[model samples]
Target: MQNYIFEIQLKVRDYECDIQGIVNNAVYQNYLEHARHEYLHSKNISFKQLTADGIVLMVSRIEMDFKRSLTSGDTFAVKLRIERQGAKLIFFEDIFNVSDGALYLKAKVDVIAKINDKLSRGEIFDTLNL
Candidate 1:
């Protein structure tokens, strides 16, 4: 079975859909980002607090594949796993239809942490050991 460190359930909203009756591609990015934030919160990490401490985590790159379309009212789950590679933290995220388990999208996000104004490995990630 595929392992996921965290998962969040969400429903497609009417406003998120395009004229084609499917979720707009950009909306999927929001869903993925929300899931990542929630996952960090679950681990007792606060994005706001990090920023306040001068530790900023920014997405350096994102690669996504759209497998299926999600329509308004469709419930789905956003799942993710994290790994550390060199100085970058990679988040592997996937979205699936909650009812049928159909994959809607898969994405890989590379994140880098900056301290003060320099790009360095934030100490916070060391605590997570991801």
Candidate 2:
């Protein structure tokens, strides 16, 4: 099984930062969310489509490491990678960094695909294979 990765370039916004001129901790989660959506889009999958097919993707856990501070007007890159864990869940990793490749935050997420409130029992990743 091969894992998939997606990279996105992002610019820090003024509103995303705090009085200290650094990004708020909660914003790191937002960056991870954007990368995750981009990854799904690259696979030709949409959350709406998945819902229509009775599939719900839910985050089970998240672990984040903040290595550096990001300021407003700073540009950075977000990289997302996903690996199959079993028939029901997938593990995801996301990294946020400066345009110069300086690391800002690293996050790991576990997500599961569900149908009818139960995890899909088939080849989960294959369902969205592009």
Candidate 3:
């Protein structure tokens, strides 16, 4: 299967920041989650469907490096790429940037797949069909 990449832009909201107006570290997870959801949506597949099929795409690990802080009203673009995928595992990478394309973060996520709702040891590549 061919590799897939997706991107989206989101504006930092005041409520997502701390007292100093800098976006909270936890908020970066939210941005990543949003980008992930959006990328899946583009594939015409949803987590609900996967669950119904007795499959679970669980995050096994996440690594994020932050280079800059984002404040309220700052618009940032997130680029997501499917680095690797299989029948029981998937790997992805992302870059978060500003309007001028100034990158602020780089993240990698590892996902493990389940069968009959149970985690397995092998890789799962079913997601590539779409």
- Please, what is the whole-model Cα lDDT of each candidate in the order they appear? 0.91, 0.76, 0.74
What is the per-residue lDDT of model 2 for residues 1-130, given as tens digits with 9 covering 90 to 100? Answer: 2243677888999999999999999998888888888778877789888888888888878889888999999988887666666653444554556666676777788777788778765466665772
Candidate 3: regions farther than 4 A off = 1-4, 85-91, 121-123
Better structure of 2 and 3 per TM-score: 2
Query: Against the true structure, whose TM-score is highest?
Result: 1
Model 1 lDDT per residue over 19-71, tens place:
99999999999999999999989988889998999889999999999999999
TM-score for each prediction? 0.95, 0.86, 0.84
Candidate 1 wrong stretches, greater than 4 Å: 128-130
Winner on lDDT between 2 and 3 is 2
Candidate 2 local lDDT, residue 26: 94
- Regions more than 4 Å wrong, model 2: 1-4, 87-92
Q: What tens digits encode model 3's per-residue C-alpha lDDT throughout 12-115? A: 98999999889999999889888887878888878788789886778878889988898899988888766555433443545455666677887888777787
Q: In what order do the candidates fall by TM-score, top score first?
A: 1, 2, 3
